[model samples]
Target: MNLIGIFGTSGFAREVGDIALAQGYQPLYIARDQTELDAWSFAGTAILESEVEIYREIGFAIGIGENAIRQKVARRFAGQLKFINLIHPSATFGQGQRQIVEARQGMIVCAGVRFTNNIQVGDFGVFNLNATIGHDVIVDDFVNIAPGAHISGNVHIGPRCWIGTGAAINQGQGDTKLHIGTDTVIGSGSVVVKACESHSVYVGIPAKKIK
Candidate 1:
């Protein structure tokens, strides 16, 4: 009977909806406005009223500079807010697994190192150990990252992109998704100098599009 409302309609929000359903929560997608958010009436004591302590436990950080993200998350946290933590059943966390140095709701983390807040991770994404991702990183859905990959701050990765082992992108700066296109494969040990195209294969130093 617990209804979870997801705030964005695109990308991360959509993925969060899927994960919410998988976890047996009634997931509802809401627009970026609070008027629309409050209009969706609940018949019972809303989780929003009871989950303030939980919200205090989690935090928010958007990798992009768009002011819209801040506005939306701020509205959600205006009163009491509830965040979600969604880990795959097969994923390992804490001691011998990915130690949860930070915790939040609507997260789909696989085995990895410490994670902080304000990170927008896409659905069904996997992170291997010794792999480091910095703050404000926007990871798209279905991203498959190999072990030992070091992604730096303010980086944006597009949906369904595969980051190869030891492959590194821009230390998460500039204006871009760092833009790894959908279904693209990055060969192991490759270095991506520029944003990659969708469904293409890039390899070697500077990661040229070979396929």
Candidate 2:
């Protein structure tokens, strides 16, 4: 079986391990030290980051949820190691057939997710449980869509944006696309109907910027 090294021992890492196991890959916990490794009950062997060079055959995945941290780690190991995309088997495509969704490296797609056709997802994007992405949606790198969030068709989400749990982004009409700018945070339960500016926090119905 292929050995997959998961960096970070958080709950999300364990979740990714389960997905890796489902895909017939052996999951190894990668940590800084033995103490950090011991804290998490991982099924496979634990190895420190310094010892990672020894495992030349292993592929890695970033288990950190924060966009900045994930981006840093991804860049650090970019040329040195191969990053794996872990998509759960239960995720359903638009049609009945299993067609390929446009997902890039280090993406973590959870179970019960649904994707429509022509969806483009960038590197290291996280689609939480049951999140739905509609047709022709463009998701940039390091974007995290929380559980139960619904992103409509022709939506362009910029890099490092966080869509909180249950947030809904309205689709664009005709040739227009609703754009969520870079580094913006959409609060949980917010309903975004228009374009959002970069580096702002949007909340409430119709999604007004608060910060």
Give me the candidate number with maximum lDDT.
2
Write candidate 1's Cα lDDT for 38-135 as tens digits: 65453222233233354353332221112234344545565455444554344433242233322323344433444444456654354544566666
Clashing pairs in 1: 60-118, 61-118, 63-136, 84-105, 84-106, 85-105, 85-106, 94-98
The per-model lDDT (C-alpha) reads 0.55, 0.87
Off by over 4 Å in 2: 33-35, 95-103
Tens-digit lDDT string for candidate 2 (1-211): 9899988888877888888888889888788678886686656777887888988567888887788888988888888998878889998887631334433688888898888878877889888889999998999999999999999999999999999999999998899889999999999999999999999999999899999
Give the TM-score of each candidate: 0.48, 0.92
Cα lDDT, model 1, residue 147? 65
Distance from true location, Cα of 138 in model 2, Å: 0.5
